[model samples]
Target: MVTTKRNKEFCQKVRLKSTQVFIVAGTCLITVLVTLLCIGFMTRYEVDNEVANVADVDYWKDKVASSQKIWYDKGIDELNEALRTPRGPIYPKNLRIFLIQGVDGRDLAAYRFSGKDLSNGNTNFVWDKFPHFARLKNTCSQQFPCPISSVAKSLWTGIPLDKIPEAQPDCGNLVNETETPFSVLRQAQLAGLLTGFVTTQRFTGSTGAALGNTNSNYECDERMPLGSLKSGCQDIARQLITGETGKSLNVIIGGGRQMLSSLVPKSISDPVDELLCESNDGRNLLKEWRNQKLKESKVKPIKFELVQRADELESLNASNFDFLFGVMANGDLSGNSNAPSLKLMVEKSLQVLKKKNQGYLLIVEQFIQSGMNKRKELQLLNETLTNLKREEDTLTLVLLTNAIYPKPILDMSEETETINQLSETFNEAEFQIQETLYQMPSESLLFAIGPKSSIFHGVQKETFIAHAVSHVLSKSSPKT
Candidate 1:
């Protein structure tokens, strides 16, 4: 499920997430600024359109090649050092963020999905067992009804979206790392937690969410780089794996094997790119990961493994390796027939992350499918949640939909027709909305289950998610 009907509408309604912040060698980066450090980001360099083309696959194949141009003037080591701070002493055992993206209030009404005290209209399955539900008022702001990108930024750095310079119309490129001084993930990592961010949704860039969508402030210790199919310029996979930041991610999964599998096509529109999607750049990163393990370090070393299929991922002994890198497709996994199920990915990631005693932060992005399948997914999730051990150390929060309905699809459907009919005809385009309100929608669903979850109540902006994580990290601090 790439996007809900709302997501498809967002494609037309929202353009900010896709707005370019920085385009170096066709590689996109967002410039987030905290102090005056971001003053001259725009003037720093001009990407020669011709030079940006991926012609010299030989030169581009070098791991350092993509980031070399930008890292030179910026001082990569200094930037990474500045970004890396000491973590706290108290590490939460389990903290997971299950973000079901692009799901609107109307989508909830598509069928009868309920939890504990939550339920919409008449329905077949009663999700009465799901627990700790709540909602956020207006998604982000007045201008943009869909504030996935804006909310993501605020949620990451604790800075309101409008306050971001990178968010400006022309300075959109700045929406990336240029202005970001810190992020929830960075803070968590500093606190010594193993972190991984996996998203079924392709690339959102700055336009998606602040640190959540992109590698802004090193959102995840590792990622499942589900790269885009765009040619010429390198996709996100190349930029991140080879980013000049120097902070290493432990595991990356998902699709877009095209980007990392081989050389990016010289022409952005090269037709043969398909055959060569998984092109060999000569630098096999999986082998590189194994090579990385050969060199012993002063600190504890990370073990590595690379697998291509779901069974292979499941078969691995989680304790045997620290860094796991694998790809399942040539592009996004949302609707891919061959890609492993999201359920499998989440379960596998959790299986591996649970091995670490320090605890972890897993960010899972799921595009909700409407109607029965959607409700079933919710049911499956609830069943999964029911099985988890929720102690003081665990915090499983699901940021479900909170928007008001657009004309109410259920209302438009004939009274005699079952919920199934309305769902079958559903298309995200027709449900697009523009106006905004913050009050939690009457039929909304948000769950804050497990240990510390009860602390959240009433209305909230999604940024509160970060605040909660921050509070835990502070306790982890040795000074505390």
Candidate 2:
């Protein structure tokens, strides 16, 4: 009787163990099945639907510009209305957005990182490879051939280029700026954020027009040439220096020494007009600005500092100032001697902007020329991205390769060295036009990373950026 009971108990124990083993095996099988299903779904979604080699120029231009032609026929007002209404902001993380633009549109064919070595060199190739580019394999996307004027307007105003006259051919300038994305920053500022504009050239043409009416609290760019202030759309500089705008800039840095009276080199014959065909204004804008800051310092908590070198900028005691304006270059830093690099300008801008305890909007740019300038700007941006500690908190938009530069004579001999050399001189002070009409098909590349940057994924409308930026800029801190 005892042996029979022990055998029966042992059989029960084996059966229970077998049941547990079956359950564990079934669970493992389900987990594997679910994971495979997910992988399949992700693989299908991530499949590159729109990628091809630019082997033929005619086909490529025809395909990309086809949509713009349809838009071009649409009345200018119709385009304006479309741009006025930017797409909804889909990204709302607590973030910062940096708008880095290539003033001239870029060509996609010339920027590929294929053919072994992925490096863009000073020696330009007819098809230069920009290895520094983070191939948009996952999320980064681009739009082609966005014109500079329309691009500038849409970027700041949230209007699309397809919806507006790119620029007035007669005026060679932007149409108007009745509105801007700065409205989006109103909420952000109440929460302690700052806004800034820094570029290598004078805020002239489209740049000046875009910034003309902004009420943001920070702005900077190369000073308008002495001749340009009258018509160069440089009134914003005067307004910042005099605190005449609705919102006073906290920091201003750029180059326009000729306009500063004392900084003009005496050797250049008619120094002002030699730089351009404009300028007779005798106002020392910078001195006037410093004087105003000094007067304001006595009555309020106002603190403002100005410097003219990268080292000086790096050494700034940013904590002491309510505003810091550093004009580190005399004018257009591109190929200029000892000019503060765009990267340094950006670094210092961010450093000072963060002190406001509010988020910031930073617009940085290289002169709209292609080749070495564009390549260097892109390389700097990549470095900046690599070093970012709080990428999640920042939105960086790098716009490259628009077809907006002045057309130059090309060698067209299939010689890499000749093409590269020509590219360096593409933006020569004295340039010749190869084409009568300087219009470009909408075909350059765009890149964005951070909170709302992905809102513009596919072929992004020019105005989409403004809307996305406004969405983040207008974000109030989350309620705890």
Candidate 3:
């Protein structure tokens, strides 16, 4: 009986020790959690403070203005120098063109990879493919690195967004229609060269619209003010269909079918279609464009094809169609399985444009976001460049916008709201959207290859590109 009692006491002691251990562990866990919470709270506080201090809208605006002034002076000097340079005898009729946008310094730096082979087992860098390509320092707009502004300046010499004082300062509004200068594509069209436009963005997006539009208040009909429409302003899509430069285009391929169509009833096959059919106007711009071509066909032997599917695009015999229009998506291209790839579009465009013996100019605009996808895009671009280089007469120009949004104001707290209100008085919201927290202006790069590529070898203003093209094409002898 005494031994049994001793065993029970020992068991009680063991239970007591286990209870004490549990309590001690619980205390340690609680203490650790509290410490973590404190650290997180402190970090968040520091971040908030940094954001508040750095996101001073007034300071940002002042810095932009000062920097713009410096660029403007430099641009003026470069423009004058280009004007003074001897005009080269470039054969316009023999020259085929590929003007590419959406490359940046990061892309070029990737080429330097310490002479190492890429993970994809490619030993040659993209630049190595075109050893003759000249690397030039390209500048963005003197005022802002807006996509529309940069494009306008690149297409029409000496004209940037800030220079157009008459047009309302907005991304959707390009040059004043009355004051609009002839674009490089327009010049090529007038010179009897077949022209084409290809993009991964909306067909009516800023880059595409700047090619042909003027005094445009919005990209789509739904986005335009009724007053503006009544005042004889047309949306970008309408401009592309009806405008002189736009109509003369031999090839038009990209996305943004929703902007062209009115309430296209979504079918079961396209249940996940992201295109919202946002047009309230009772007109289908695509049909209108087709009808216009059809009417012309009745008068002449004009062959045209309009397609909405990637498969349809693939099946098309580009040589059979004098004009090709393909809207591969409802909105901006998502590079999905069904959408036509950038390289595919370029190949098709090349086929269509090459048919015209008078020569051709193709504007390929791609908007690449930052990160790993950018690398993939660079690879695709290299493939396209290879195809372009196959034509000995083709001159390909790659334009890059580095950090398109420079020093973006990230914080939009109460303090920022107050700054925005103050800035609204000075039209800051016009160029820089009040709600946008990212994107800042930065330097860009220019790469060129083929005949007369020497003209763009040095650091020059963005306008110099158009100036050089104008000089070469206008002064050159026509092909026999």
Q: Pick by lDDT: which candidate is best? A: 3
Error of 2 at 445 (Å): 3.3
Candidate 1 Cα misplacement greater than 4 A, ranges: 1-92, 113-131, 139-141, 144-149, 167-179, 203-235, 243-248, 263-299, 369-372, 389-392, 402-445, 476-480
- Cα lDDT for residue 58, model 1? 30
Q: Estimate the lDDT of model 2.
A: 0.50
Question: Residue by residue across 209-280, what tens digits does model 3's lDDT show?
Answer: 667744464666887866677656777778888898888889999877777887654544333244433677
179-236, model 2: which lDDT tens digit per residue?
3344333335444556566766654334534644433211222333433333434444
Runs in model 2 deviating more than 4 A are 1-151, 160-192, 214-236, 239-247, 259-273, 368-374, 401-440, 477-480
TM-score leader:
3
- In TM-score terms, candidate 3 sits at 0.65
lDDT for residue 463 in candidate 2, whole number 0-100? 57
TM-score of 1: 0.55
- Quality of model 1 by C-alpha lDDT: 0.50
